[model samples]
Target: MESKDLKFEEVNEGFNIKEAIDEAKRCLNCKNPLCVQGCPIEHNIPAWIHQLSMGNIGDAMSIINEKSNLPAVCGRVCPHEKQCEGHCILNKKDKRIRVGKLERFIADFDSNMGLIREKLTPKTRGKVAIIGSGPAGLTVAGDLARDGFNVVIYESEPEPGGVLMYGIPEYRLPKEVVRREIHKIEGLGVTYVTNCIVGQNITVDEMFDQQNFDAIFIGSGTAKPKTMNLPGNTPRGVIQSSYFFRMVTLNNNGSVGRNEVPVKVGDIVGVVGCGNVAMDAARTAIRMGAKEVYIIYHKTIEHMSALQTEYNEAVDEGVQFLWETNTKEFVGERGRLKAIKAITNEGEKVIPMDKILLAIGSQPANRIVSTTSGINVDERGYVITKERPYGMTSRKGVFAGGDVVNTPQTVVLAMRDAKKVAAGIAQFVDAKKLLEE
Candidate 1:
């Protein structure tokens, strides 16, 4: 490994066993449990914390597995400040119980000690084929597999984890943690097929009719990154933050070279936008040995979509923030990016930059919809799902959820949607089988 890659080691070292118990012991285990209400998937926060406090690692994991398939991933990445921990009763006293850290500790301890290995249920319910092995697809597969449905996930990448294994940076979420979680899911009788693109290699029709998938789920996330399309966007150094993140991850994992990673060492990099992705890109640039990394946002810090914790960490890591700055144009020459023309509060400013990474956001790709006949999408190409069956698409046996159906969301939000879709798929499959019998 390159000496520079050492900078990418996990920044946050979660609680030790003793520290976790001490923190978990502080949880009030409230009857109302506002933390549960705050969670997107309604995790039984109090129960798991209580279990961890008692050193019942297996019990805590069982509680977590009831609502979550990727406890370790969530423990690391979920926005605790805005959700569960935010609503903790102790927050009023400035003592929020450190729920995220405690959860991380429990998950790590459980995985390390092999405290809980669930018994696999027979796949007698039905066979469900899931597209994309992201948070949503894994949740659906785990949930249905527990309920006796045979689940197979098709992933286009070399590995099963979609964004978890690729899009997210290594420092925040280690690939090993992701692999561990996926390994747990696979233990539940779920099958994975990598390097398989749903739209191209096989179509929805083949899965439903030929391969005999009783229900099909689309959890494929937003693949097409959105760009500002400024005057000099076509320049060589102008890159999409998502693509940059994916390539850098691949490079770090030895699948690709440093040259393929896009951002080079000692480069002066400026990232456009102020969301989490923008923070990730800028911070990643710093770790890659960039001379300077700047986050250029048109809005004030008050309006930033990034978590305050993430922004604070980026600042601590020496990331420069350009706030309330409106980008006018990309000023470059020789087909390579060099500077950005913008207007700050003071007046017009020309910012010199060697590269510009756009972290604006993205939307779902039309690959599956365009290739399939029955599944319908909205004007913006998001799959149209019904509310009655919950995540059922226009076509009867076809279902869609996660970022593919709604706009791009956080990992936990995607899992929440996928869980509902899994239930809906189970209902549809059960009814069809009964009628045929």
Candidate 2:
């Protein structure tokens, strides 16, 4: 199917009502609840499962909302096998309860029924300025807004979801799902200000002095794309997976236009690196009508960083793997990529391709640290935060979390860090207010 047509349909069909209830029935309602312990936010897994099994869908959603702000998104993107489902007691028998799927079912059902969770708290706490509207910033905004804090999110991009809106592909996590989740947060009185670069448009001091924001949470994620330092001039066909994703999935209002598809319909595409981004790139190329898609990685399958399910899906969709292969150079004609010079276990190999996508990694942009003072960053430029307040930067009342503090391995992991930072922000805001009084 064409990518344009596939954009609206999720890769995973998700669970219907009957499937969700049957999955919920598998939950043993463990006394110790290893699934809850396994969750980063400590969601009451058994409680929700019990509610679902008893057909109280609304009550089950209420239980999930108590601790999670993005149940639908998390259920689709989270690495459940390594976290929640992996820790299930039934997993020993290979029948772990589908916690993630059930969560998605409840959240989707709520959204389809137009059943919005009621506003949690009145705007009482002082204002907070959150930089970046990604997972971490959204979590902090959602958590604090529920506690009556007036929150304003300043997003650098035209839209608010940061990586979630741009980096991840539509097949994996649909844009409408993200918008619905954002809408829920907005219902809590969380205001979003897009196209506002913190360093360029406004300063941290201005947030305090002009905006009267009592505290600042810096969740400005790692936006700088990392390259492989390949020889020769960077070719036209070579691009970062993140950029390529933004081009394809940003609904034609983005840099990549429908008329200017990055990979030609019959082009051969090579994706370097074996992470989830690489899988996404390869699969997207297939849907875009690529002649062939190759995931070239230096390591073996077991050592690949991508989720097992993602890798399996890529293979099912006709993506080939050049395992134990190290890329050396991009050979091209007149600035357009033509072939790749690589070395495998058997030595020199040349793989001809029309396009090469780099899915190596990314680093935090220096815009925030270079523009602000007293915010300590590591040698690699990640913001350094204290363990006491969990995500407080060296500069008091200025906090950082998610990929800015630690490059998140997954969306849920970023949410975990942001949840702690939200609690710290609340405590800091309350204390700061007491001192002023």
Which candidate wins on lDDT? 1
TM-score of each: 0.97, 0.96
How does model 2 fare in lDDT? Answer: 0.88
Query: What TM-score, to 2 decimals, does candidate 1 have?
Result: 0.97
**How displaced is residue 62 in candidate 2, in Å?**
1.1
The pairs that clash in candidate 1 are: none
Please, what are the lDDT tens digits per residue for candidate 2 over residues 1-437?
A: 22221333578889889999999998899999999889998999999999999999989888888888899999998889988999999999999998999999999999899765675687887899999999999999999998999999999887889888988878788888999999988988999999899889999988888998989999988899898887768878898888777777754446555656687677889999999989998887777778888999999998999988999888877889999999998998988888999999999998898999899899998998898889999998999999867789999899999989987567888899999999999999899899999
Model 2 lowest lDDT segment of ten: 1-10
lDDT of model 2, residue 328? 90
User: Across residues 79-127, which tens digit of lDDT does each residue of candidate 1 receive?
Assistant: 9988998998899998997877877888898999998889989899889
What is residue 40's positional error in candidate 1, in angstroms?
A: 1.7
- What is the lDDT of every predicted structure here? 0.89, 0.88
Residue pairs clashing in model 2 are: none
